[model samples]
Target: GVSRIKEFDKGFQEAVKLAFNTVGIQNAKPSNEIANTTPKTVETIKQQEIKQEIPSNTYTSNGVKYQVATTGNNSFLLINQDNNKVVANFYPSSLPNVYHVEVISDKGHYETIGYSKDNSIIIETKTGDKSWVTTTYTK
Candidate 1:
């Protein structure tokens, strides 16, 4: 079984190398520079700009930093210095019996995340709703 797995892995590696050579970046490592080979569509590029604008998320040219707000929801605001616009707005949803609240923004970055009854955490940050990065609750 292990031999079969190794053989499959070897074949996959060869195929990947062939694909890389086909694209002329033969020695590319599967990292950010290599993975970003797919050119961003105009819309996706816009979204990144929007994501950067959201003050609630605290994204900088350096990187997005997650911070727990001290003033609570909505009070935390960030102005996108680059675009001269507001970043995000936080609010509670009317939906009954829900854990997390909603963070809405003009840049189309909306999300809801909260803890579960079973002592687990859930996050939704998709088109309609997306769950992201649930970790073992610490502190």
Candidate 2:
């Protein structure tokens, strides 16, 4: 059965090649012929490295001061200024100027959505069961 299958495959390949030749289709150039063609010169560009300054802004929410800074990897760190502790991490969401905030503490782990507008960041945080509290931090 295997030998018969091999013969059938060989015959099919030949028939396909004949059909291509009948339609005036030519085979691709061999690797050596392609390599012998004239080589094209590629222009090299010297680009200056651009340095961007990351903004570290401080804001206040309910009289508590917080500092927000970029982690340089498309994420923002929310730090409490009183003790310099990272309270939450904000990651960019699909929507523009919107972020998903996550907080982990001895109490529990909480997740919420936040957005930046003007000079303020408004975040809707989960407080108790089925309760969402909105807080706005302004620069």
Candidate 3:
């Protein structure tokens, strides 16, 4: 049961960080990786392959505490528990095809390339180099 919770947490947090790190407007199509894997994962979840409802866990990294929760349908909401405000939301739309993300922060705003094998979120800009940021929230 704990392992199941961890995996779902893994999926949710990575998706959130993927949205958070994306800075700047970018037009992105889901990579072959997402197209190949996400649909099955989402479908499996829909079929109850994995448990969906899990309690939010808190982790402190560099003095920042995060509350990550899985709402539904592979969607997650992250909040700054210390501040009691929303941090970012990561939601998957139309799996097995193109999944796009939008993250807005004081730093910048960008879109998602979905999640990667290494669990890092890559955000791309419309007409520029690709920048990557690794976010750790622990499963």
TM, every model: 0.24, 0.55, 0.41
Task: Give me the runs in candidate 2 sitting further than 4 Å from their true place.
Answer: 1-55
Compared with the true structure, the alpha-carbon lDDT of candidate 2 equals: 0.72
Q: Give stretches of model 3 more than 4 Å off.
A: 1-55, 93-101, 113-129
Candidate 1 per-residue C-alpha lDDT over 1-139 given as tens digits, one digit per residue, 9 for 90 to 100? 1122357778777777776777774574578877666557755554542211112333342343333332453233334456555443334232222334344466556545543223222334544354354422211
Q: 55, model 3: CA deviation in Å?
A: 8.2
List model 2 lDDT by residue over 9-33, tens digit each: 7877777777677778568667987
Candidate no. 2 TM-score? 0.55
When 1 and 3 are scored with TM-score, the better candidate is 3
Count clashing residue pairs per candidate.
5, 0, 4
Give the Cα lDDT of each candidate: 0.41, 0.72, 0.54
Distance from true location, Cα of 35 in model 1, Å? 64
Candidate that would win on lDDT: 2
TM-score of 1: 0.24
